[model samples]
Target: MKTLFLLLLVILFISGNKPGLSQDNNLQKNLGADNKVKIQSIIFNDIETGIVNNDVKKFSQYLSAQTYLSLINGVNGYYSSNQAYYILEDFFNTFKVVSFKIKETKTAESVSYGKGDYYFEKKGKREVAHLYVTLNKAGSKWYIAQISIN
Candidate 1:
């Protein structure tokens, strides 16, 4: 009887420790979230660098198979990766980027977006507009799904 009682106590103790495991799980989840934010920051920073340098090729690798572009040049729709390259190339050729500063980035579920101030010179006139970039995660990696410069 004592052996059975001890076994029961051990079982209860093991079960009671499960809550502690959940705390560890929660800690892991928090760490994972932090890691995700850091990764996004890095990715967005790279994109910002690409814009600042007026080189879409620097960020072309991040484009998804189909990227949506909403631009001031009356271009709005989904485009293939190759198409996006030339499209962005033309855009950069037209409006020379003076400076680009990403304001904030936010993520929800598997999608992350960053809004920035895009300052450029068009026809010798300096102008500014909001640049919004969206990224969607596929598996363990994120890809650029949309870029809107308006």
Candidate 2:
């Protein structure tokens, strides 16, 4: 009778312990997912504000080393992070951003897509352009991997 009682206690303890493990695993998964979403949000916010303020340094922070820029009229180029930084610097020097707004955003796992409208003043004329961007999580932070202008 004592042996049976001890076995019952052991079984109860083991069974009781499993829910804690499951809960911990679930919590970890949720936390990781939430972190991905937060990273995406941060990347978008930085890019939008950077472009609006013509802050090339702020924009460079969210660009990966192997980022690619594609224009709507079939001009595609691959740029290192440093190249991208200089490109943005030149762009900011050329045009003044009048206003910028994000039209929509979609996120999935480690990827995010954003569409936006940008108003720029170039040579004293205001021009509007549609911007499409894709960002991916790289390590612990999100980086802009691709951008297209239309």
Candidate 3:
């Protein structure tokens, strides 16, 4: 009887440990999912407002330190956060944004991609372009890592 009781106690202890381990893994997965949702919301808000106002300062808030931009003609360039802000400033001066709208957004892990339609008034002529933007999460903030216009 004594030996049987000891074996039963050991089995109970081992069984209890497995559930605790599984719970911890579940918690981690939930936290990761929550972070991805938050990052997506921040990126959408930043881009939507930035384009409408032509505000580089607001736009740069979503950019990482090592952001790269590609233009419509297959031109590629990399910029630091500050440099990217300056480029946006130049864009604001050159073209007036009449309207902007986000067409779609997709998220994966720590990256998000967005496509949007933009209407611009350049030299009193209306032009439309589709913009593609990619964002990556850095710590607790999401930043724009790449942008392409075509």
Number of the top-ranking candidate, with TM-score as the measure: 1
Ranking the candidates on TM-score from highest down gives: 1, 2, 3
Shift in Å, residue 37, candidate 1: 6.7
Q: What's model 1's lDDT at 43?
A: 67
* lDDT digits (tens) for residues 6-118 of candidate 3: 99999998887766533234334445634553546555766788789888665666677888877544547998888877876777567678998888989888888999887
- Candidate 2 residues 1-150, lDDT tens each? 999999999999998877653323433454563455355665677678888888867667677888888753354788998987887677666767799877799998889999998778878998887888899876656678987766
Per-residue C-alpha lDDT of model 1 across residues 33-111, encoded as one tens digit per residue: 3455355666687789888888887678778899999999889999998999999989988999999999999988799
Error of 2 at 112 (Å): 0.3
Candidate 3: where are CA atoms >4 Å away?
Answer: 1-37, 72-75
RMSD of each: 13.0, 12.8, 13.5
The Cα local distance difference test for each model comes to 0.84, 0.74, 0.74
Query: Judged by lDDT relative to the true structure, which candidate is superior, 2 or 3?
Result: 2
Clashing residue pairs in candidate 2, if any?
none
Clashing residue pairs in all predictions, respectively, total 0, 0, 0
lDDT of 1: 0.84
Q: Name the lDDT of candidate 3.
A: 0.74
The regions of model 1 sitting more than 4 angstroms off are 1-37
